[model samples]
Target: MEDKRADVQELSDFELYVYETVAEIDKAGGAANIETLRNLIDRPEEDIWAALSHLVSANHVHSTAKGFTLGPHDWAP
Candidate 1:
């Protein structure tokens, strides 16, 4: 399987931060939603949503009923 880190080079600074934030929250056993991201990151709702969209489209993140979590590649070896 492809590694997600390889795709990080293509992301913008904010996008990278958002992706990392989602991973961090997931690592801590919490799901990340727009509200959770907004509260953690200092960016506005629009920017966070945009970043989430990009990350999801890139397959670096996944949106589920629980919330946003890292893609399979991110968690797998």
Candidate 2:
């Protein structure tokens, strides 16, 4: 399968949901970790990880030792 990268705006619904969830967590002063995502997102661990990978590659989300955060490209108003 071709691993074509999609733009942030063109991200799949699930990907967007993951991105938004991370953002929400960050806004709430909480770390957007895998465990936290698993708790909030009603999806399997693999799916969440995949969404996060894509988001990180697209610079929509930044991953750090602490957790996920908004990348250079701001999605905020």
Candidate 3:
């Protein structure tokens, strides 16, 4: 298997959870809005959104009027 340590070093467990959940949303052809994301993931609202903020700043995810999506690079920092 490919080593994922370098790719995911910066993300906390919850953040990884959020990121993966977002990917799932993408696979399902759905956007990850705050309300929907909250329901899909098991983390607390604050923690989920907090991870999302980090993901956005790192360019690993992007947000739109509709919702969040996997960013330009899927496995980037």
Candidate 3's error at 57, in angstroms?
0.3
**What shift in Å separates residue 15 of candidate 1 from its native position after superposition?**
0.5
Tens digits of lDDT, candidate 2, 1-77: 53444476779999999988998888887669899999999999999999999898887888899999877553464
Which model is ahead, 2 or 3, in terms of lDDT?
Answer: 2
* Cα-based TM-score, every candidate: 0.83, 0.82, 0.79
Provide C-alpha RMSD values for all models, in order: 3.0, 5.5, 6.0
Q: Which runs in model 3 stand beyond 4 Å of their true positions?
A: 1-7, 74-77
- Give the whole-model CA lDDT for all candidates, comma-separated: 0.84, 0.84, 0.80
Q: Which residue pairs in model 3 clash with each other?
A: none
* Candidate 1: tens digits of C-alpha lDDT, residues 10-56: 89999999988999998888789888888889988999999889888
Model 3, 1-68: lDDT tens digits are 53122256788888888988898887788789999888887768998888989988877778888899
Candidate 1, poorest ten consecutive residues by summed lDDT: 1-10
**What's the C-alpha lDDT at position 65 in model 2?**
95
Return the number of clashes found in candidate 1.
0
